[model samples]
Target: MSDRPATSRVLVIVPAWNEEESIGDTVTEIRACVPWADLLVVDDGSSDGTRGAAENAGATVCQLPFNLGVGGAMRTGYRYALRHGYDVAVQIDADGQHDPRSLLSLLEPLGESDIVIGARFASKDDPYKVRGPRRWAMVLLATVLSRMAGTRLTDVTSGYRVCNRRAITVFAAHYPAEYLGDTVESLVIANRAGCTVTQVPVTMRPRAGGRASHSPVRAAIYLFRAFVALSLALVRKWPAQFEDPVAP
Candidate 1:
């Protein structure tokens, strides 16, 4: 556990879309792992019973009018965190691939940095591996982001992460609003905004239910789009701080 004050509010933000089978268990596991933290599930217009399942599992539900992908859903959570005056916020996948037990490890570094990514590839002992084209793509992204941020980043696509108040404020204001935009682009934005970003090794588990949103065809399309986005991010100038307060 972090040495931060007990009153330091921590929120676990789970973005779910048709994850009815696993969202409930994901919420329950998070409660068990971090009993003091509040839970918020961003239901991204899930057609199934995801919102009800999350509510039953003891999480506050934030329903979107339509599916806005992970980036939009997480941005909603960030806005919520800022509005609620939370000291820290963590994004956990609703698919149960992210281990709740690793929350403490991710939070331990938040005292020194604005963001702490729970990196799957950061540990050599971890058996999880990204194979084929995806593996190559991650390597390329990691290399680019590492150079841009002036820090080593092993997992550019990992969603398991913790962010402090400053990070939440920045993200709430200008988070990327496109598909897969939450991963690499968010890091670039954070670094450009003068937020210290770092990573900690964490083991990832197989998804508890449902299939990944990415297929081979989708992955190819994402690669081209990601390249274009990353290039733009590198040249774009950003403000030193976020001035606009997000309205609840």
Candidate 2:
């Protein structure tokens, strides 16, 4: 993160799936931390009362008809932001892992960066550490992506980040919903499409409630998928027309 810029019309998108217990609290906390931004909870086909919880907590809810994972929900949120004339978009988890207070720090680099990632490992005294195969995969991804981006990125898989209009436009048009596409491949697409990416240190909290999508036992699987996503991203490029989503 680098230079600061004037910001207007910010939307905080939270993708929730059966996270009724934490969605309400997450919304309230965000409203407390960043009261100026609009909140959108993309309920990813939750069978529970996630929609009601979010609505009661004072968020606009967009309930997906079925579960499409985090990537799909985030793509929907990006499109919603682009259509609603919002100039900035930020993705925060409904499980309470992403701290809302650090949002301002993440936005600090907006003028200098098109996409800013809230990297957990880059922060001081950060407790959210991944180990085993997952940690190895993260290191590899960060190393490869850092070389590609010409910057040091400690956490390439982080979802806690902010995007300006340029980044939003690119994502709205070509964001993928594949396994690791949202965080990994999407960055590749953005870089290929000529968007600048950077990251800032952020302290993430433990999940307040809800189930985790990945477990320790699944670290090996995640490692494999991460490589696959990276491979596809390296070989493929965003189409030429997506260079500018706002042009008529």
Candidate 3:
């Protein structure tokens, strides 16, 4: 067994959508990696047996009323974490791409920093087809957004991340629901709130089952819409009155 952090109160929130093939394996692997973590699987109205599989794998399941996409499901988990008073909450994708063993690296920055995101390209294992023009555009967009937000955030599209109690509270209250661009939006919100954001390298692979939800056409449209929404957020100062030390 790997050594776990003593001060870290970690909860693994997995958002699932027809990931019956991988949910059980993913949960079991996460348990093996961080036995101390409280695993919660948010079933995003999957037609498959993802919910049951996750429960059987010893993970606490939260079935969403509807398919709220990744961001909404993640916020549901975040609300639970806040209500339960967890010190840290980490988001993991339902697909097998995100390595469970890398939980330690993700949480290390959370000890002192407010939020830590996993940088996928730090050790890229994604297929070139998956990493081609789409991800390239995402990285460029993230870089521009980071500069505007006064931070140098990498991997703004990554699903793996760890957040402290303060960040959890902030997100649980006002997470975006329209699109699946939580990474960049969350990073921007945290940065504007004066939260210290950091990144750690992580290894990721392709999904185990089901096709990717975002097609190339959908991705391009999402990118333009996301950019507009984020721009509006920046101009409006939407996530208002966030200070360094949010009350516990």
Q: Please, what is the whole-model Cα lDDT of each candidate in the order they appear?
A: 0.88, 0.90, 0.78
Cα lDDT tens digits, model 3, 1-248, are 47877876778999898899999989998898888889999999888899999999999999977798888898888888987878889998888888878888777777678888887665555333345446666777677766855666667778888899888878887666656447767776767666777778777778876677677787777667667766755665655564322246
Q: Pick out the ten consecutive residues of candidate 3 with the lowest summed lDDT.
A: 238-247
* Residue 75, model 3: Cα distance from true site in angstroms: 1.1
For each candidate in turn, the TM-score is 0.93, 0.94, 0.87
lDDT of 2 by residue, 200-226 (tens): 999888889966767876999989888
C-alpha RMSD for every candidate: 2.1, 2.7, 3.0
Pairs of residues at least 3 apart in sequence or in different chains that clash in candidate 2: 2-109
TM-score, structure 3 vs. true: 0.87
For candidate 3, give the lDDT of residue 26. Answer: 90
Model 2 vs. true fold: TM: 0.94
The segments of candidate 3 whose C-alpha lies over 4 angstroms from its true place after superposition are 123-133, 148-151, 213-216, 242-248
Report clashes for each candidate as comma-separated counts: 0, 1, 0
Off by over 4 Å in 1: 1-5, 213-218, 244-248
- Candidate 1 local lDDT, 1-248, one digit each (tens): 33334568999999999999999999999888888899999999999999999999999999999999999999999999998899999999999999988888788787899999999888779999767666777888899998877889999889999999999999998888775579888988998888998999999999999987667877777677767777877777888777648654
